[model samples]
Target: MKTELLEFENKHKLLEPTSTERVATLEAISEYTENFLGNIDTLPAFVNNVSEKAPFIQSINFEEQNTLNEVLKNIRLYIDTPGINPASGGHLGYIPGGGLFYGAVGDYLACITNRYAGVRFASPGAVLLEETVLNWMANLFGYSKNYGGTLTSGGSIANLTAIATARDAINLKAKDYHKAVIYTTQYAHHCLQKSIRILGMDDVQWREIECNNLYQMNVEELEKAINKDLNNGFLPWLLVASAGTTDVGAIDPLQQLSEISKKYNLWFHVDAAYGGFFILTNKGKQLLKGIEQADSIVADPHKGLFIPYGLGAVLIKNKKLLHKTHQYLANYMQDASTEKVDLSPADLSPELSRHFRALRLWLPLKIHGEKPFENYLNEKMQLATYCYQQLSNLPDVEVFNKPELSVFAFRFLHKELPLDKYNEKIQKAVMNDGRVFISSTRLNNCYVLRIAILSFRTHLSTIETALTVLDKSKKIAEDELYQELRNN
Candidate 1:
């Protein structure tokens, strides 16, 4: 053997840090962790706006080493420091944006270990851990033995993957996917349209469902459209239902939709990214009654489970369908020595190198247990109802749809101003004040304000603060509206 080869083997003999250094490193990390977790309520004050006041940018500098103690002190300071929030202006408003204790630790350990969970043959242990989490998610939605799925980065990718699976399953028997159609509400998230575009099926018919007064997809409209499509020689490939809509927390009429899917032989998929995990709670389970009948589901632990983002899963009722659609062989990546090499993740997702994302969820569930997560979700449900009650009492505020889950949409009903003008003024006022962050949308050609109670930190007090701010904005907006009327 070459001397260089011998040197490489000798140098690869594990690079573990010394115990004395490890102890010091752990202590430093502990101190930083304490600081990070302690000050959750410390809201930031608006500092200099970068666009208004140009801030200095630092360039690459000379390398320097600090003592571990010094490094820890600086890290503590860095963790505590708050920068201008780009999402909500400079004011120090934050959503519960929860910090899961165990998940963080798991992420740190996974990073240190550098585990690749892409293939069963390369790392069976890592792959098994991920598969276990996927199985757990499948069971959560009442998926049976025939169902299986894969984890993705977030709800968008999960939706994309589910659509891809639907495409593959339908296209297996048919030649022209261009004639295939998808059904979803106009209020459905734009991610669905983006996914269709990505799949090179942009020209395919997208049936925009008509919503009732409550913002739910009208099941009758869906049936009518399905029949019309069939008569016109269009293939109804999928029916996408919303478990919890992004705008106003509107849940589509799932039971009726399920029946329609069964009658029409359409692939039924539920986008439960915001409300799926809440299936653990009584109210949530009740709200999502027909979700169990779905052929596929998209759920985000990041949003509903209160974990940090980068965790989403797609559960399909037919596991073999996923394998049938995505399985492909690569000779170089496979080991020929073993007669059977088990399944690889490359056989599932488009990615060849999957990260150890499962540990983030597994660690949290293991350490804190399921009871706490269930309780947390149940609390959010109550909070959303409380928000509705609070807004109902406000003078000019009109509650749009009573929360189907932890999301609600509403708008101000002004007697003297048109709906659009009043809503525009109100949105501007609330956003400019920077007291609370809320989003707005157009439902039925009318502007509607949307508040989704997603943050675990949101409480009755948060809702109360938002209402008080909304009251102030309403008065200001009313005055502005009257002034405009007078001026005109």
Candidate 2:
């Protein structure tokens, strides 16, 4: 039996690579990534290579081993080359987060070390690193030392965890889920609503409060709704406000909403996934007043800090509530249990096994310090203002409202064509142009193009190029539509 086992082990020895193999693989990856970064500005922000005829093969087979070179080539051709190039600065459509090179370096080191960051007993340094990052965010938001939070995959997951904590803290079982109420504005990210349903509170009285012309939630409407809900014997347990909404970057009246939450005794959760870090600036601090008062807040380092697309954080003022909501107990985890060790990530998050996400964010925060990020955020806000101004000045263009942070919406007004179809045509045209990517959304039953300026690489030149592209794309769209109508 021993001899047979030895033979099997020998056959599978390829699983463990030698020093030479490791170096070669690392070198290849480094070269490929460096080249990709060097040429990122030249790449299209959005490209659709998969037509009906040539979709990606669904089956991923490891039946045959491929060389490193072949694998890298295939990755470049099939994966990175198609779809939205998120790393590109021209990605102004969604909240763009330019993947910082320092972040990439940190990711490399984290992956190589493979630290068990989920628990302190396994890797104290790694766990502390994560806690330190969370603490930094807490300090930014004015959360006290009594508070705790967790590093999550992104805004979606971060919101999920925070919602779950709120759910548990309320101590309402499934029976009460149907009667509970949640109040939020229309601009709140869909992820929050999804989290509500996922938590078995689908039947909760989810109210979409009215918004003003700028798309910010109306405080009067919110107060009336809450009071009405209370009068009607409904449980108004949660109040959600966006620091920077996704569509138009409209920040709800946080200070006003916080006061209402206090009066009604509700949990206030601020979704600052895109605009949280802006507090590093003086204007941002003024705009985000009362954010420190949130019971819990969600922020994405990816969007606000330009540290790639996978880091999100949640800060809760009540540490005990967060711990009670997420902490699990089992004999297997006895070794990790202690009053001292932590209160670590496993106790405060939904994840049992977590990637070393803190390193990626921490390295950049350390290398560049906070001043650069503050300046970058201020720059993005200025860029958004510039874009709004430029687009508004164009003939026959409609600007929605003044940008509150670093995003705004506008659409081309075509006299001859139906506005909806014309704007959709323009969206397609801009996407096809591939020089810059833009997205459109329906605002009050009207189609409008939305631009979120957050990419660190997006500078004055990028905005100028995008303005030119938009002009050309609109003309091309106009001609194409006019020709089609004439043919018809």
Candidate 3:
């Protein structure tokens, strides 16, 4: 038995590499990353013609030990090469997440230390670090010192936490789920609906308030809907507004919506996952004026602050309600039950074994300061305006709403081909060209292209390149349509 124990221990020691081995591994990883970053400017944002059964899929085997070089080779070829290169500056699709180098370094240090930040007794310093970051966000959004929040994996979970807290604040019971009424525009992020389902409140009455041509919710219609619900004996419980919507960057009439929510006695929650951090800029502050009045707000650092993905925050004005919703106790966690100056993240969020996510945001803010992030966000808004102007100038293009933040939709027109079909062809051509990536969404049942400019790496030059690509793709799509017509 002693000999067997010694053999097992020796085998386990392999998991902790020697100092020399660690250095070599780090060097190799550094070299690969440096090369990738060096050519990032020239890399295609989208890679077409990906194989259905790539080599990486076949290489997945855990029975055999592989060299570090071989592992990186597989990652390069199979993981990073075949799809949208999110790290590329040309990534102008859906909401773009920033991949800051300093954030990655912070993640490395956090993983190496492996601090359990969920409980204060386990790691008081780690807990304080997270609390400090959340407090900073709360203050930025104009919350009082009584505010509380927790860092989540991303906006989805953060929004879920907000919804759960709102539900419990009223002591809503399962039997009354059918009577609860929630209000939001059609453009509200789908995560809210998912949250309702997850919380077993799917039967709650949902009123999609009408929006104006600019996509801002129509305040008069919203009030009418609320009154209708009230007359019908339905409880108006929550109002979810957008600071920046995903599709067109539309900001609902926030100040008006807040006023209505207050008057109607409904909880006002703002989903600013894509545009929350914009509050750092002067224009953003003016645009998001009424956001400070929200009962709770969901924001993503990865989106506005240009940090790498996986960092989101939720701020609730009433700290006690947040704690009441998510707090739990178990016998095994008795050691962590001691009272402390700060509330544990585990008490305010559903997660218990969460990653040390605060380090990523903290390191970047400390190293680069807040000025650069503000500048980048302001730059993105300007770039979006520039792109909108350029697209509107084209003879055959129809521009949609002017960007409220840094996103808008547009579509190309062709005389011979159906409008939707022609725009679809144009979208395909641009993606196949692979110089820059763009996405599409349907508005009023018409296909339209979308550009979301939020990546810290994106600049005026990148937007110009996208314009050039659009021109080339337009010609290609036209020729293809003509050829198909002739063939028929």
- The clash count for each model shown is 1, 0, 0
Clashes of 2: 0
Give all TM-scores, in the order shown: 0.85, 0.97, 0.98
| Best-fitting candidate, scored by lDDT | 3
lDDT of 1 by residue, 1-488 (tens): 69999998677753466788888788878876675456444343222223432221222442654576765554434433334322221121222244466767878877888788877777778788888888888777888877868888888999998888888877634356668888999878889999988988777778898999888999988889999999999889899999888877788988889999999999999999887888888877788888989999999887777677678888888877776667766777657215333555556666668778888889998888889888878877787788788887778777778877777778888776898888878776776665566667877678888777766666666677777767888888889989988999
User: Which residue pairs collide, candidate 2?
Assistant: none
Model 1 CA deviation exceeding 4 Å by range: 1-33, 44-98, 172-175, 336-342, 417-422, 428-435, 476-488
lDDT of 1: 0.75
In angstroms, give how far residue 138 of model 2 lies from its true place: 0.5
lDDT of 3 by residue, 323-393 (tens): 99988878897777667346798888898988999999999999999899899899999999999999998
lDDT of each: 0.75, 0.88, 0.91
lDDT of 1 at 74: 49
C-alpha-based local distance difference test score of model 3? 0.91
Off by over 4 Å in 3: 56-60
**CA RMSD of all predictions:** 4.5, 1.6, 1.2
Reference-based lDDT, residue 301, model 1: 83
Query: In candidate 2, how many Å is residue 356 off?
Result: 1.3
Poorest lDDT segment (10 consecutive residues) of candidate 3: 334-343
Ranking by TM-score: 3, 2, 1
